[model samples]
Target: MALGSLSHGFSDWAPGHAATANHAPPKEMSEEFGRAAEAILIALESLRSSVDLAELQREYLTFIQIILNEGLGSVLRGR
Candidate 1:
C-alpha cells in the first residue's frame, strides 16, 4: 500500500476503500512503526532455524497475534 494510504488506515482503522480523512502520522509514531517492522522482520528471519513444523506454526501464529493485538492495537489507540 502507498505510505499515505497506510498512514490513513492506521489513523482511522478503516478499509482502504472507505472514505475517511487522511492525516499524517507524527514523526515519533512513524519511527516506532519502523522499529516495529524491523523487529518483526528479525523475528521471522530467526524462525528459519526452527526444526519442528507444528511448533513453528504455533509460534508464528502467536507472533502474529502479538503484532496485531498488542503492537498495532497500542499504536492505533495512541497508547
Candidate 2:
C-alpha cells in the first residue's frame, strides 16, 4: 500500500487539533470517542490483513511490531 494512502487514512480516521502550548484539555465522556476507538480497531484490522508477514522483510516486520506495540498498545491502555 502507498504510504500516502496510509497517512491519509489515519488522518481521516483521527483528525488532530491544535492545543495551547501549555494547556491541556480535560477529558470528557462522549459517544464520539467510542466511535473513534471502533474506527481505530477497524483501521488496524484492515492494515493487518493487507500486510503479509511471511513475505515481509525482517525490518518491515519490526516496523509493524513497533507500530502495534508502541502506537496501538498505548492507545488501548488509555494513555
Candidate 3:
C-alpha cells in the first residue's frame, strides 16, 4: 500500500517508467496482447454467464497459458 513500493511493482507497464525504457514490447505487439487479453476476459465472462457451460477445458494446467499462449496466440498469429 505504500507509494514508494508501488514504483517497483508497476515499473514494467507504467507509462514513462525508467524500468521500461528499452524493455517495453513494441506497440504493435502490445496492442495485439491487449486484444488477446480482452478476448480472454470475454471468454471467462461468457462461461460465467452460461447456465450449463460449466467449467472450461483450460489446457494442460495454467489458465492464462491456455487462453493467452494457445488460443489467443493462434488468433493473433493469423493477423
lDDT of 3 by residue, 40-66 (tens): 556566666654433332321133342
Better lDDT candidate (2, 3): 3
Estimate the overall C-alpha local distance difference test score of candidate 3.
Answer: 0.42
Superposition error at 39 for model 2 (Å): 0.6
- For each predicted model, how many residue pairs clash, with residues at least 3 apart or on different chains? 0, 0, 0
TM-score of each: 0.37, 0.26, 0.37
- What is the lDDT of every predicted structure here? 0.47, 0.37, 0.42
Q: Taking the tens digit of each residue's C-alpha lDDT, what string does model 1 give over 1-79?
A: 1322243335432223345324334546646556654555566566756656345445444433433443455679998
Which candidate order results from sorting by lDDT in descending order?
Answer: 1, 3, 2
Candidate 3 residue 51 C-alpha distance from true site, Å: 15
lDDT of 1: 0.47
In the predicted model 1, the residue pairs found to clash are none
Q: For residues 7-26, could you state the per-residue lDDT of candidate 2 as single tens digits?
A: 22231122132443233211
Displacement of residue 11 (Cα, Å) in model 1 is 1.7
Q: Report the C-alpha displacement of residue 38, candidate 1, in angstroms.
A: 0.5
